[model samples]
Target: MLRYLSIIFCAATSFSIAAQGVVTLDSCRAMALGNNKEIKTAELKIKQAGYQRKEAAAAYLPSVDFEGAYTYNQKNLSLVDKDQLLPVKTFNPLTQNYEYELLVNPSTGQPVIVNGTPVPLQMALLPKDALTFNTHNVFAGAITVTQPIYMGGKIKAMNEITHFAQDLAISMHDSKVEDVIYNVDAAYWQVVSLKAKQRLAEGYVSLVESLDNDVKALVEQGVATRTTLLSVDVKLNEAQIALTKVNDGLVLSRMLLAQVCGMPINDQFTLADEDKETLAETTLRPATFNMDNVYAKRHDIHSLELAVKIFDQKAKVARSEMLPTIAAVGAYHAMNPNTYNGFANKFGFAFSVGAMVKIPIWHWGGLSNKYKAAVTEARMKQVELDDVREKVQLQVNQASFKYQEAYKTYDMTCKNLRVAEENLRMAQVAFKEGVSTSDEVLKAQTAWLAANSEKIDAEINVRLCDVYLSKVMGELKIY
Candidate 1:
């Protein structure tokens, strides 16, 4: 029953304390990486590029397509408006030829002629109705297969471009991950820095409270004046106000950190470093200044390189448009009202195999101009890549220099903090021995607070510097 009560009490007080859970830098980085919208977008782009690459690869193989069409006509097809013909022919084996039979006049036993016309004795009738065709529903369908014989290098270049695009997408994702990690680190450390300052401010308030008491007691005994007491009171109030400000800043900083970690802004959590008196010394890694290595490690640089290659392949694709293209085609055709069989109302099937060649003869130099533009675009990308390389190199150098200088600043602040602590201790002892005034002791305490605050700032600065340096070098690790 007691344990259950304790659990309930703790749960109730957790949010009030604004310290419910503990999270480390590594956990924060992982959370941000998993939840960041920009990172997710980049990952989606990579997937899209992968599908595009597959599509380009499919171009290397044959494709089959099917089409079917139907039509209905209101009227039957007519071959002739009126037709009447009668003629007779018999084979004459004696002459090895056919001759027309003529109508004979029985009275004269000779061929009959009217108006210089020979009359046929026998004839075959061809009626107009026989020439009419049935035309109601017509159906046509075809199944075609096409394989690229030679596309003047367009297919190959396009395939290569897709590969480059996929690589570029991956590189862009890596770059985004680096940026996310850097931002999360900055926010996390800022909260930790402010937490430390809050503690320092509270300590300062306590020291001033003690001084005020001492001065008040002295005034009652006539050793200190009322003016001195008022001064101590003012200092105590200032220190308390400073502590309040620090607390407010800490709350906001924690909120920002939580947002970066993809958590609710109002969520309560404690950082691993928040309770520590000092941040651990950062392990300084040696930086390699070799640009080749830097270029290899930096995702943005790699992305740019890939962009250049993609453009080069695009230029090749454009040039291919001006070249001759060849393709192999095969089809199976089926149609009703088969002309292959004397216009019978039955479906007829036919298969054909052929090849198509397209030669770009003249388009007013359009294809040539397009190819030239593509080449120019490729060259422009190369120039941009070079320009970015110079800027990134400078950025790397600046970040490295600042990272080193931050350590030096931290060391100096560390020394000043120790000195300040000792100075305050000596001043307190001197005042208790009645050799120094309370004002001197108050001055020492204020110096100590400033020193501690500076140290905290310096420590946080060093951490941020490391994060920035790693990012600029494109070596920002996951943890």
Candidate 2:
């Protein structure tokens, strides 16, 4: 009784653990999307694109800058003095009249006489240093503002290109999300399929064990040969080995699912039970496909469309580069020892406003060639867009066909499972009535196991095909 109680307790603990670890498909997809490295990188790309768009928009606004500088000169500036003359007037004692010295010769040391009397003597003057500049500390500061009046549409085109690039990043992020969902779905379904196969393997082992017991009893009663008992033992051993192998596979499959869901790889978990009958019923339901509108739903196609728009903007930008640009500029400057107003050695403020125009002149045909190259690139992007549309349609069609095929295969396997179950039942009845051999019973059991395994695979395939089809159609939504 104690042993039985202990077994029950252990069973309950395991069940509780499994119950706690149970996860749904949607939960796995959400976890993977949150933890996937690629998804995180794509999100970062979107943010970068947003920053670039803002940078482009900034070009449309006026720019203001402040500048300051200080300098020291080695020598002071000086001004030269001009030559001058002065009249000398004095009363001459010998002549007793007022005389003015008109001229004086430096070499002769005599004054010239005017009207028979000594006139005023002219004295020569030499130049002397008059003005000087302070060379110690010079400082200047300025605030300048510039607004682009006309850039030949270059700024507008660049802004549009950035906007288109942002859209492209969003589309690429969406595409990455879809890929993550598909991978999670595949791993989740694989775990489910392996669980089902493990159950079947356990059942097979039980059946073989029962057959071995019956054969042993028959051999003791002389109703069956020892060889029969040995044969049953061999089948039992093989079944047990197969069960062990299946169990290992199931554990690995669960681990794989855990890894995909960003959980600890060694952590054991239970999958939520899937309703196979309901899945089959839903899968068989008819669905309409609108191939014409499918391309619009594809993220890749959206990305390509945005690429074309970006290229178109590039062409406009290149052409604009060949045209003239115009701008309005204003500046307010102050400097120590201001010289523009006067010869004052003090700080003074001055302001100026003006307009500027830049025209593209001779460039050795460089501008024209660049414009032509841009046009060619735009055309190339258009071609790529067309190709992607075609490819998206093709992928959709192929996925549709594969879905159909998966459904048909699942149906066929379902029928096969029914037949195999009935065959196993008949073999058991015949073996009890002594109308069949142990070998025949073993063969039936094997066939039944094979059929069940195949049916599980078929079911998983159908589900995966559904996922693929939705992915190709761009209709898969995992929240």
Candidate 3:
């Protein structure tokens, strides 16, 4: 028995140590923003867009390129060089003939062919077609730079478009942050709601246990039947079962809250009691925001507006494709034929600067099709902007109506809780005076528990819906 007591004491101590940490509302919000996967992804996208916008803005700057190459060539120079060929006379190793064929033979009708004798073969005329000019090996290097002289304002338009896109990315990041905030709020409120229900369940169990004791006392004094005492015991058992269910629900609610706050599942945390009290006292109401004003102010709406602007700039870039691209180019080079020679004797430098303008004479209507596509996409984005406006207004209206409905429900439930408490008090008094049955007292207790549960749910929904409505109006951060 002493060993068992020591084990129990150690377990209690461990539990207390594990459950010591607490999380406040502000801390939860900060951790969610820092650790939530969705928010982290949004921040990364914003950073990527920032770099892309910088790249687009840097398009007006000059660009420089360095190139080097080596080549080898072995071929004839020109067709007019006739003395470049050489002839030879050799022994008759294959045909055994000192043979010669001449067009103008003086002593015979055919060219003379003397077998096994020395012969003189004159230099033959070389084939004039096998010649080239630029045939020697050469190595060249050059550094060229080009600046955007004019691009029909396409570069500037693209820069403007990416600037707007960066703003849209930032707006999207803001929306993700808001979503994280809403999740934390809802999860924390759920935990609070379940805790309240658990308290009510425990209270019901206690009341039923007390009634069971009283009925047992009356039975011992010959004032109550055994059947009545048994009924009271059954009610006590049912209350205990309800209390167990509530405890399980509270544990599950706490786990959910931890998940939303991006904490480890095994990590124990207690929510701030003051925060729950403040949430219970907060009023539910719609913010004063006009639909027209919201369409201009909300990040989601503004992101789409910026999208339309980007498409407009894209259309300009597409139109610029029909015009010519002009730029100046210059280069210098050196050539050498000897393998051992360096840049001294075998070096020659040449430089020429010129403006090149390439005009597209015709295509199979490719340029026209691209320009049409750009125009179509731009108009489609315009329609999308209008759609976003309609959607935003609908969401705002729905959230506002829900806020009002929840507020009214919360108010009614508060009044009902008071009535339930009074009813339970009167039923207890009547039972003590021999004017109420055990069933009547049990019914009143059940009603009070239900009323308490409903009030807790209604109160939580009011605060939750208020946060939702504020998120819709983009006023959550202000709160």
Candidate 4:
């Protein structure tokens, strides 16, 4: 008993929520747009493109870099001894006296004499070693700044490409929004169509039931045969079955609509009732379309055009790679154990400024091939753009033709409905006056039901066609 009571309460709550208000087409569109993941992704892409543009622009600014390093050598650097000569005083035994001697010139290999006496000269070469790097720890640091003076227009091309990417992202976002709106409209109208059919099914069942009751009464009064009552019963049963199916279909259709609107699948809601006569009257009227403006407004066409521009910019960038680059460089360097001047354990600072040029001398034709590839890609993009334009024109023409056809069908069904209604009324009058059989009445009722169903289908088709036309023309307002 508790479980049953809980289920009943939940169902009542659902019904109360459903009865709060009707979900209009605009409301559904808003909900879908707010919750759709595709739209959110597109929005993120736009932000990403914005950052890319900034990154490309940053290439024009100066860049600063800092570097530091420390090292320990196994041994200090040393200079070996240099060859040299020195004069010496010596005693000559042949002279029997102490005398000063001159040193011999090493390169000339000749003895030197003083006062016409040949004196033996003695010389000695001294050996000395000097320590070049005595310190075990070395530290060096430098800060450098570089500014690009010329880059063969690569930066400009890249900036333009980023701009094109941003435009493409925005166009894609608009296209996604249009798609969401189209889906919502389709789901909303499907529910509306099913609801109309459900109502028609209910009315049909009621009609058959009333006829069955009248036939049973006449049979009991001996005014109608049992077979006539049995035939009415069969019609009533079939009509009830059809009503059941229609009701089930209407529930499912509503669920589908709710899902499309970003609502819970099981969430129940009513649709704002649209008057069929008003819809038919409004849609039956023909209006002229400006195809030229429609083509211009299409987001896909704009996106393709942007893609072509982006490709062209890429080609420019590729061509720029083959040209020379120029930049200005400035640096300040400081190091401990200053070894540049000598082996001194003191920190010293130095600064310098200069310009650099990098000319592409040889690359085995690689740069030329890359530029050619970029050009070919740009050409392909242009061809694709042309193809898209042609396709857009074809879509517009197809949608226009479909709309016209749907309107004609709706008009014909409306006339047929009127005829069917009149035929049913006449059949009922004849049956009451004993001129028509039960079978004739049943046939008339079936014809009326068929006509009603056809009219409903026709009306929905017209509405769908209108939506298609608007979407193809890029005039559907998603916001």
Which candidate has the highest TM-score of all?
Answer: 1
lDDT of 2: 0.81
Off by over 4 Å in 3: 1-20, 72-137, 274-280, 284-288, 334-345
Candidate 3, residue 380: CA error in Å? 1.5
| Best first by TM-score, ranked | 1, 4, 2, 3
* Evaluation by TM-score, superior candidate among 3 and 4: 4
What TM-score does prediction 4 earn? 0.84
Cα RMSD to the true fold for all candidates: 6.4, 9.7, 11.8, 9.0
Look at candidate 2 and give me any clashing residue pairs: 100-119, 100-120, 101-119, 101-120, 101-121, 102-120
What's the distance in Å from true for residue 94, model 2?
35
Cα TM-score per model: 0.91, 0.83, 0.80, 0.84
Candidate 4 residue-wise lDDT, 1-479, digit = tens: 24224434543443444458556677777666766778779989999999999999999999999999998978766554454455566777999887667657678866665787555566665544443456688889999999999998999999999999998998998898889889988898888888888889888988898788878888999999998888888888889888898888888887887777667888777776543543534444355667678768999998999999999999999999899999999999998888666768898889989999989889999999999999999999999988888888888888888889888888899999999999999999998898888788899999999998999899888888888888889988855
> How much is the lDDT of residue 134 in candidate 4?
68
CA lDDT, every model vs. true structure: 0.87, 0.81, 0.75, 0.82
Candidate 1 lDDT tens digits, 296-359: 8999889989999999999999999999999999999998878677667999999999999999
Writing each residue's lDDT as its tens digit, candidate 2 over 145-204 gives 999999999999999999999889878988988998899899888877777777787898
lDDT of 1 at 124: 87
Which candidate has the top score in lDDT?
1
Clashes of each: 0, 6, 1, 0
